[model samples]
Target: MLIAFFTNNYKPFVGGVPIAIENTARMLRRRGHRVLIFAPDYDGDVQDEPDVFRVLSIKNFNNTPFSLPLPLTLRPAYDLDTLSQVDVVHVHHPFLLGMSGLQLARAYNLPVVFTYHTQYEKYIHYLPFPQQMTAELAIRLSTRFANSCDAVIAPSSDIRKTLIERGVQVPVHVLPTGVDLQKFRGGQKDFLRKKFNLSAETQIVLTVSRLAKEKNISFLIRAFVRLCTYNSQAVFVLVGRGDAEDDLKALARDLGIANRVYFAGELVGKELVSAYKGADVFVFASTTETQGLVVLESMACGVPPVVVDAPGVRDFVHPGVNGFMVPEDGEADFAERVLTLLDDEALRKALGAEALKTARRWSLRQTTSKLERIYKSLSAKGQPRGKRERFIMLRELISYQFEKLLEEVDKLF
Candidate 1:
């Protein structure tokens, strides 16, 4: 099968959506399928990648790392002839390239699949208006986009439930991005300790996230300060970098935990795996996750996470079995749970064992097979856009574009 993906961001940009797209495409190719990607061009992005297409874009928007794609027209980024042969059209965001994906599908009479990757409302701080206003606008636009698609892929059942509640008429599939078990397993346990030159007795509490506001890194830092009172050996090690790095570092320093916190920047491949393995416990407090891929990665490396209860996170966790899921609030409770795992090695190892088993169910090999089935199912029922369907889509596209313009204006005030 041939699949075409229209995504707003891609590799060298650093985010969950890009990782999901790249890994899924890799598995598809290995399974004897071809894939094409259309994404915004970023300034330091590696050139000449296979089966990838780039359109004009502002590499940074308002001093932020987000690239604003300027596709200019519905058919700007894709080739008419190549697009006609694609079996499926998959889109990762609900705007920009995502809108373009829907347009191409409508024009060519192809089945389009939309993935609900992020909780749109949580990250609307990047917009100019009050969060509530921008959030409402985000919901309306995303719901319309999902309704127009042949199918919507929700990374968790909770997200699917939310989509249904929001009046999404199309079928919603629960398909979380799976982990590569082989790549994550059996990482060198002493890797981080040796790299940072820490004593073996020192405990590492790790989190791999893009240090951003929506990630709730500030909350975690506060909780870590409280945790320090209980365990003198514990040190917080954060992986990944973002616009919020300076603020987070400042927070740690002000809280008098700067010496106890380590910013490891970003690590990938074997080093990333080792970082996961080196940690005694994985900690996270993000309430705005679609599916916490890093949680699964931590579990895959035999490090049980003490994460707060959130949408995508609630699906995989079995408290007292794989790992502990703290309440939505309360730093005291969150700290106590981490201390529980830290103080007891046997209990931590026992939970970590079950975590490895849980990780197996969502392996890349299994998820890829599920993806193939989804594609085939859609293809079986596929039909070209009839006159009526074309009319409806064309009208919806115009409305969507106008709404987008209104949003830009609203940002100013």
Candidate 2:
């Protein structure tokens, strides 16, 4: 089967979404499927994956900060002659690339599948509009985009539930972003700690995420400061960088934990793997994630997570099993949970062991195969029949009405 893997960003523009797409595409190709990636040109050398095709040279918009590509001209390769050759169009994001893929699929009369990767509504705080308005717009846009696809794949049950609540009539499948087991499991703990200047006695509480407002790094800083009251030897290492770096640094200073917090900004490869292995506890406070890929990476490294009991994290971190889930924004509870894991070596070991086991369940091969099955199922059903097509058309009309209503509301306020 020929598969077109569409995404907003790919390679060198590192993130969970891109990584997941790369892994799935590679695995699918290995399974003897012809795969092609449609993505924005990041001005990097293309990888030499025989079965994978790269379509480049598209113009990018909002190039600063986020580096999102705003496609100026979109023509399906060979006037969608090649697109017609593909059996299914699997889009990883709901924005530009996904929209392009959806349009091409419609033109070519091909089966379309979409993966809901991010929680767009949670990130509305970063937008220019008011939070309520931004969230409503996000919901309407996401619902419309998702309803277009024959099947929607969500990384967690929480995301699926959110889509259903938003009136998505399409079938939603719960799939997780898988991790590389070999890269993260065991070994080199002491060497990693020594390399990072961290002592064996130091309790390393780590977080790896793009430094963005929606990541809620402020909450992590506040909670870490509170945790310092119980454990002075605690060290906070933050990986990744973004607009919030300065604000976070200032917050750490104000909390009087500047000396304890280390900003290890934007690490990859061995450095990233080592950081995960060296940590005593892996912590995440982001509420905007559809799936927390870092949580799985940390778990694969046998580092237990102290994450919020939200959508994506809950799917991986089971309280008293692999890791503890504190209530969202519950700074006191977050601090206490970290302290509990840090102080108790026995509990940490038990949780870490179980976390490794749990991480095994979400392998790249397993996830890709499941996605393949869904794609095949959709392909077998072919295009929507008379009543089904009408139903979809009606849903699209309702979605447009909702979008107009949101626009009017925005204009009013």
Best by TM-score: 1
Highest-lDDT candidate: 1
Q: In candidate 2, list every pair of residues with a backbone clash.
A: 61-70, 240-266
Q: Whole-model Cα lDDT per candidate? A: 0.86, 0.80
Candidate 1: residue pairs that collide? none
Candidate 2 Cα errors over 4 Å, as ranges: 43-64, 76-79, 125-132, 185-187, 381-413
Cα TM-score of candidate 2: 0.88
RMSD, each candidate, Å? 4.1, 3.9
Q: Backbone clashes per model, in order?
A: 0, 2
TM-score of each: 0.92, 0.88
Worst 10 residues of 1 by lDDT: 384-393
lDDT of 2 by residue, 1-413 (tens): 99988877777666788888877877887799988877765554656554343444433333334445554444533345878788999888776667777877887778888899887877765556577756766677778778878899999998999899989988999998788676665456664467568777887899999887888889999999899998989999999988789999999999899999998878777778878888899999888889999999999888899998788787878999999998885999999999999889999999999998888998777787798898888787445711113233346557766888998999999
